[model samples]
Target: MPTPDFIRDLRRHVGTAELWIPAVRAVVVRRRADGRVLPSPEVLLVRRSDDGAWTVTAGILEPGEDPADGAIREVQEETALTACPVRVAGVFAHGPVEYTNGDRCRYLDTVFEMETLDGEPRVNDDESIDVGWFPVTALPESLAEDQRMVIGWALDAGAPAQFTEPGTSHTEAAGEPAAQHD
Candidate 1:
């Protein structure tokens, strides 16, 4: 979809300043006919209209919205798919992305491992040009780096949510699970 009304309103005051936005990604995975997710599973991906890059369904979280709900909402909005979030797959800080319009944003992104509840994939909104599923081993070459990492987390069944630590690159931190604190 277009820039959300809340962000547009914020832009009126901030004017291209870097804003820390909360975003969510739904890495919707499809199980085999026998209900098996292992070996090789399919993942839903969209080809973005702006960049034509393949990525999982993702969008900015609405104010006060739960992150998982935001992820489900984005999947429906962008790909016409109803999904249920199974677990948080990862969380990461991504981007000081400078848009063509000069809006800059750094996103604190929550990634969810989701299952498709219903509906076939289709480009349901202006944000994406196409939508389809691909096996994890055969993902599009144009998939974004961060998205690839999040998908990896989702595919690693039973793994804890992945997180990056200070002074570590995302690749270096990929295998590290979020620490549990007492």
Candidate 2:
């Protein structure tokens, strides 16, 4: 039989494995320009406190927290933007590799099109460094590739349409099935 230390080491290694099955949360998106809800010219984006990664508001779901509630809370906490849940854009099994923390956790990213209520978003320094509005065509350059894909999917699928696949982020553009990440 292995020693306790051996078991500890084994767990440390396997704990990070996808088999570990970490819980993931949904990501939310909002339309600004020419929106049915808010006739505006700006869209919200968040600048992560770490890595300065600018992207749509998102976060991990807490134990027993409703997925929709988590998305609303995260976006509000990260961007301070009041938004109404519109529809599910898609779901993706992603990010089992890396994160702001060195420790890895898998992500089940649910893309949503939320409607902004009032007050432009300002970054909540605890979770994000900066938050502001931008035109869809002139989004900040710091957006991650994944964000680009999500935004692309939202634009292509015309938010409000339901998507449940990982490629819901790019199915229309792919012509065929969009490449699955997980």
Candidate 3:
């Protein structure tokens, strides 16, 4: 049997056909400075040059890239921040998404909480022309509904009401959930 088109695109980076899944990743960026969390937590976002819409720093993982490592790398590449993805914030299933370039695919987005180390980011790739930090309170009006939702959750990652799966215990301060967005 031949692989389906959706599956083929999903596995194009893979060396061989095996059990497979299509995935997306984003770095939920946060600043390390004090007094940063308040009425709104500013997060790094990029406006795609292709469609003129804003989105979290993200990308499809390469066949061999560790999912978590790819999240870190994508964020760095998009935001130009020296940061670390400290923990997985949550997973979201964004059913088929259609890109402006004619790529249609479903993605299971793995959101990661990232801590930044230095300087603000400049636009780093053709996917985007502008990148900057914005408050969780007033995210860009153009963000994709799904991207807005995940960024909203990531901002409240320091709160203490949301559920964190047991294995996500590597994070010491992982209980608080932020209010829903989008």
* lDDT values, one for every candidate: 0.80, 0.55, 0.59
Better of 2 and 3 by TM-score: 3
Model 1 ranges off by over 4 Å: 33-39, 168-182
TM-score list, all predictions = 0.88, 0.66, 0.68
Enumerate residue pairs that collide in model 2.
Answer: none
Candidate 1 structure quality by residue, lDDT tens digits, 46-135 = 888876777888888888999988988999998888999999998877555667678887777888999988888899988889999898
lDDT of 3 by residue, 96-174 (tens): 3333334344454667777776666898666678888777777877565556656656666664323334444312233
By summed lDDT, which 10 consecutive residues of candidate 2 come out lowest? 173-182
Task: Write down the lDDT that model 2 would get.
Answer: 0.55
lDDT-better candidate, 1 vs 2: 1
User: Which candidate comes out best when scored by TM-score?
Assistant: 1
**Candidate 2 residue-wise lDDT, 76-152, digit = tens:** 76677667666666566554454333445445666666766755678654666777766677878766556666665
Residue-level lDDT for 174 in candidate 2 = 39
The CA root-mean-square deviation of candidate 1, after full C-alpha superposition on the true structure, stands at 5.8
Q: Return the candidate ranking by TM-score, descending.
A: 1, 3, 2
- Model 3, residue pairs in steric clash: 159-176, 160-176
